[model samples]
Target chain A: MSNIIRFIIKYNLVFFFLLFEVFSFYLLISYNQHHKETFLKSSGNVTASLLQLSSGFTDYFSLKEANEELSRENAYLRTLLPDNKIDKEIDDIYSIMEDSVEYIYRPAKIINNSVNRLHNYITLNKGERDGINRGDGVISARGVVGVVRYTSQNYSTVLSLLNTQLKISAKLKESNFFGTLEWNGKSYQHAILSEIPAHATVSTGDAVVSSGYSTIFPEGILIGTIQDYELISGEGFYNIRVKLSVDFKNLTYVEAVKKINKKEQLNLENRTLND
Target chain B: MISSLGKYIVNFIIIILAQVLILNNIDFGIYINPFLYLLIILSLPVNISNWLLFTTGFITGLIIDAFTNSIGLHASATVFLCFTRPYILKYFAPRDGYEPGSLPVPSHFGNAWFFKYILIGITAHHFFLFFTEAFTFTDFTTTLSKIVASTIVTSLIIMIAQMFGKRNKRR
Candidate 1:
């Protein structure tokens, strides 16, 4: 017994090392699924607060560019708004008319962004407190960015358009042809639009916009235009190159689109799919 | 003892912050992240007990794992390296016995010995880390490439860190 005790004492270091390693291995295997303890997953509050403080100082430097974007969007929206005189005349002509147009844009700033990664995620300065939630579509003036995946009180993360997991339904504006826009993780400026039927008359410089198939984004948000295309023999789909409208390398600010009736539409679609 | 403990704590915080804030965010096309926290393990006092070394390594790795959202990757790799550190020192020890309280750094050990020690320790840590993180030998070639690339990058960073640290200590 004394000999065994002495041996154990002699090799206690090795035994402790083995024991700790085995325990760690057990944790790894047992939690096979991604165990996201959100509290510890992100930067701590103090660090995040410090980052936010620094970002605030940096944001002030970009006020001019941000104002330019806002004014440009404002000018575009002004063109869409009908003249007040025409609206009054039309309302007088039709007493029972109903307003049929509504638009909502939630402004958000990019707190952190990376364009050169395979699975890059952009962190935004808006979150649940600012009415931004998961599945909300994010876009810049140049094109569709991505959908929000996760959110915190003061921040949200968007799966960038350059991610392989993203698939946004898009259609060629000139023709009725449409396909899914997917990033191949190669270049940020280019992506692959697949599933376009080979028979469609698609050409270079053709406009591509959102198909409105998903409730996250509204119809007709600009995605990109076709740059190049190839028809594979014996395959029904066309492999088309797309030049993305947004310059991901220079991304600074974005707008999160919140569809008011998203839940109702999703529930209805779920019921139909079930049936 | 108290000053050493304080130094270790400060080093622990600085390494982790540098890793997550700067290094982790660097996506250099391929996943060749440099894990420099192992310097803490490699810089311990020569006469420190092995159990204390292992425990310190395990805790340091656990702190990193907690921040990076990996369950046991850093912990496993660190334990593996810490377990082997004594054997490596014995294999490469100088003809004259190591001086008491002499810390392991490039200046204390010659450049060749320091390089050898750091290369082996970082390689062992990265091999076990990438292997378990990938969790497969199915794509043996790809995994091997990752191991090689990551090991090279990690070793370079470790060496750079050692130089900087040694210079700072001289001040």
Candidate 2:
């Protein structure tokens, strides 16, 4: 017993060092698992709320720019109101259709965001109370931003489009050849569009937009324009680089898309698969 | 000794506040993040005990982690820095050994020697931080470049801050 006591006293620092390392690693694993879970609670919520308080101070500096973006978005949305000529034309053609109100857009302010990391996230000021929920699509005035990942009572976290885990369905505006948009973890302004067939006629300036095949986003929302593309030998797909339209560095205000019939549609699809 | 203790307390608060509130907000594109908070650890009294040093590193990192939402990245890296600090100090030890109760600032030991020490410590911290945050070498070159750029920027900031620390001590 004395020998053991003497050994511990002699190497106590090393033991402490090892103990702290284990504690840190434990924190790392648990925190990452919490982030990975569909709904983050506890520590994530506390930190996100703290970030909300800090962003309140820093969010003022960008008000002018944010105001300009919001006004531009308002003008665009005004042109799409039900009384607009385009809608009247559509109403004339589809006299029997009343499902046009499938999606609703709720405006929210981004309280905190980070783009420097591999798995980037954006925290918005709206959450469950504001009708926001997980898996809903979020778009800025310029383009698609991300999908909601976690929601607290008053704040929500977005799985940014830049995240490696997020694969957005995108298509070329000209040819309508669809592909998956993914970030290469390099530049925020650029993402790669893959799975495009080699025969698709792609150019540096071709527009890329959301496919809307998934219930998250409506059809034809702008994503970006193609920067370049290549066809590797023996590969059946074209690798295209897209220049993202949304300036993630300046993303502030966004709209959360609410698909009213999303639950019914998912249920129907699941039933079909089960059958 | 009491005055020195008070000075350290003031420094600890200032460094943590500046790092979390100001420096973390300054995003110089994705490559260069200046970790000025490590300066708090870098400037500890030279003859401090290993256990105290490690604890200081862990606490400093934990506070930064809580603010940044980065979890354990800073905490682990700072602990790693504390572990290697003694060896670094031994290598850069003066011919006559360290002066009791002295700081590791450039004023106490000339600019060249202090710069070397800061460079080594900051490089270790930044390398561990950037790589561990990445958790993969899938894009090896970019991560390496990020670590290199961040190391240079952080070292420069520390050197300039040390210069100020020197001036303040003279007063």
Return the clash pairs for model 1, or none.
none
Best by DockQ: 2
Tens-digit lDDT track of model 2 for A93-142 = 22312245556677788877767767777878788987789999999779
Error at A175, model 2, angstroms: 3.3
Off by over 4 Å in 1: A1-37, A54-103, A202-207, A227-234, B24-103, B120-153, B168-171
Q: What's the C-alpha lDDT at position A132 in model 2?
A: 86
In order, the first chain's TM-score in every candidate is: 0.76, 0.78
Candidate maximizing lDDT:
2
* Candidate 2 lDDT score relative to the true structure: 0.80
Task: List pairs with backbone clashes in candidate 2.
Answer: none
